[model samples]
Target chain A: MAPQDDNVDAVEEAMVAEVEKKPIATIVIIIAMQTEALPLVNKFQLIEDHDSVFPKGVPWVRYHGTYKDLFINIIWPGKDAVLGVDSVGTVSASLVTYASIQALQPDLIINAGTAGGFKAKGANIGDVVMVSDVAFHDRRIPIPVFDQYGIGARRTFSTPKLVKELDLKVGKLSTGDSLDMSPQDEAAINANDATVKDMEGAAVAYVADLLSVPAIFIKAVTDIVDGDKPTAEEFLQNLVAVTAALDQAVTKAVDFISGKCLSEL
Target chain B: MAPQDDNVDAVEEAMVAEVEKKPIATIVIIIAMQTEALPLVNKFQLIEDHDSVFPKGVPWVRYHGTYKDLFINIIWPGKDAVLGVDSVGTVSASLVTYASIQALQPDLIINAGTAGGFKAKGANIGDVVMVSDVAFHDRRIPIPVFDQYGIGARRTFSTPKLVKELDLKVGKLSTGDSLDMSPQDEAAINANDATVKDMEGAAVAYVADLLSVPAIFIKAVTDIVDGDKPTAEEFLQNLVAVTAALDQAVTKAVDFISGKCLSEL
Candidate 1:
């Protein structure tokens, strides 16, 4: 009986090791702004895809390289070549995410960017949050059942192991096209129970869900939504600081996922 | 030389007849709500794709059939199954349009829906206007060069021949997630020179352009943005009437396009 028990233990340990070694090989990180993408791209030493991996005339930029045992690509919807604005809304986010998935065929997606946080939700200037859920705050379809549809609530890929391992803050994220929130948006955000809000997370989540791809949102708080200062002023002032914070958090997350399967994360 | 010239003319006439008979084949009409989709679906006698031509578990609906010489499909973002709310915004519009293009490989796309028209732009309720250009009104990123990017302006397919033949009013269409306009939205809409505004038009245009599919927008005016009544009230009151108008206009457009090439349109 003692010998049999020892043999069983050894077999179980071997199976666990085999599962741990099955890595999430390919990962696509979707960032809406060049400023936000630059740090992660540099940190990963990803080279720009100069041959125009995306559609030829569109401004979508892709940077890719192998980091550790993982094949990583960071995609920026890219500045509108003519307008020079970082394409920073759900429309651009969904398009780029869909394009990246179709081209790269990644096993996992990471939507990393800057977002405004709510102080009432215990957020600070430079905190990185692992978004647990995402919803829309500005799509106010007022019809009977459409009120909920307008919210477009979606659960992000579950990453309890990563959250716990990284000691990251977790919160619900709300998305909208506007930087400033209206009264209606505020009500919707409250309904969503969102602690953080951004221009692109939920849209990315929606695309990922549609494709049946696993996605995680890692957002750094750049401004306080409930704070007294104007949103634009606070957002600009804190963006640089939060980008650094975001970079560090995402780097940790990637490292943690290096040799692990999505189930382990 | 005269006999040879007559032979060349005969060959040319045969070529012309062959080209005219080639047919546009598959066309996709993207509508945001079931209310907008029902009339077109019924008019065309399109059969609902209950087996899910779209991805399983998504709320997107597809109805397809042949009309005259054209194979037509009508797609609605569909109500959230659980919430029972119509998915009526840019995010849903983009997703469904992208999915439809991937699945159907449409030769041309028609975005037919109802919109809020402006008295300032000489819009009358029930008037169906062919959108010449489409832009976003609510993506107000006020950065130096990003201002133009935020507007996300795109030209609809060139349909000067169709417009002249059909005697339809042509105007620019603006889009936003919200049914109600913000002051900022007003400024952007003015900048766009938009006569009509809706939740889904530009998003559909964006996806269509990305895929190199020619798309036409035929929006029926449902509410006057500058009118005395509130937007929601006016929208609800006029939705049924405008749906009929939208159906009639779309039917005419479809009939006109039955045996024409995209270039001919």
Candidate 2:
């Protein structure tokens, strides 16, 4: 048996309480960066890279946690939309990752990533924001304006209520088929009224809803959509603070869902 | 050049100006039937069974006009809703096909097909009906009751000037996603006040409008969605009358769109 597989099942088996008791997760934290810190976060078990299903060299790997009943799965979809990735390819990757997670049957879904702040006001780099809705744009069916083929105008599933209760400030987000940050495109999008841009949320939302799992997506505002103000380096300087804090939040979320770590894993 | 490739370019060339100068197609028929006759209605063309894009045997093939742009193009979907096939699949397929047609730049679009009469007034088989507006009864997306997905909804389109001149009787239409029907489903649909049920016209309209194309879709009443009434024999009885009349109308459309056949090579 795979050591990681055994660890997850053990936690799930040990945490059975009531009929509705979803498996108590040991603890799993998702990060946007690659660092030797994987062990530092999940207790130095064994973290190994695995083959990703998407052709784009995106990374996905399973981590064996130091605790007897916990393991973490990590996936990295390298940088924003302009890396020449199509929306279909992005959705396909997200679906495979979500399905892989479902096969493991985790109690909750957490997607950790960075987003471009299209905010006209207050939102700045390093603010942790919870996504309430995800709109997949650029899926042009070459037809009318109707959302018949899963356009942004079509709402998939509302963010789950339990997660919504966390009272995160809501924002409308859009995804382009590829990374294009020209002024004209940004102006047109601002005209459409979305405040953030990201690639993976809609795919995560689409498949997770189909599989009956609740997904909680958190993003660290990484880039401003061609704003007039700050220099790029000045903006990224705050990322370390955001990643460290976001990691703590992910840990709390994992522990709350998986009771085995009620005291310590 | 491959003969089929040569044929395609010839058809494309013919459609250029000669195709545009034909009299405005008086009526566009939208037909989606699971089992039906060949594409050309009254032309005494012998049909040699050929493999179609569909794996499960195409029941119909164009006797030269449709695929060659004799009338516009012929689309054969393997399924239909109401008394025929799956509603959602056909609806989705119709949307995609029509979108591609628009991409090809059509001057007109008509949905010609079989539909179940779900009106309480009780329609028998083979009656010709023109739908003014169509609404989709069962599409739900987190919206309040004040909002709907507009399946068979009334007056959904602007109903172009030429269409009004033809002066066909107006009827309401609603579509279900499956061929399976129940007396109660019939009753529910009847109560919603739609006069007929079919798979793809309104859906076609939804996308056609997005592409800014003029469209006219007409259907032949094939099944009564209400309580048990017409027999299958009675339905097939008018097949000749319906097909012949439809053939005439389609010819006029071809003539209008083709501006009289151009000199052939």
Which candidate has the top score in lDDT? 1
- In CAPRI terms, model 1 is classed as acceptable
True contacts kept of each: 0.55, 0.00
lDDT of 1 by residue, B55-122 (tens): 55577889999889999999988775556667788988997888788788888899999999999989
lDDT of 1 by residue, A144-183 (tens): 6666667778899898999998899999999988888877
Q: What is the per-residue lDDT of model 2 for residues A1-265, given as tens digits with 9 covering 90 to 100?
A: 1124877767765653332354445222333344323423454445554453332322334454444345555544322222221112232334334435534665455665556676574567766566656665543222222223333322432444424444444565665433334343354356445666665565565445544445566666766765664533433555566566555545544544444422221
Candidate 1 error regions (>4 Å)? A1-23, A49-57, A103-105, A228-230, B1-23, B49-54
C-alpha local distance difference test of each model: 0.86, 0.46
Judge candidate 1 at residue A213 and give its lDDT. 78
Best by TM-score: 1
Q: What's the chain B TM-score of candidate 2?
A: 0.59
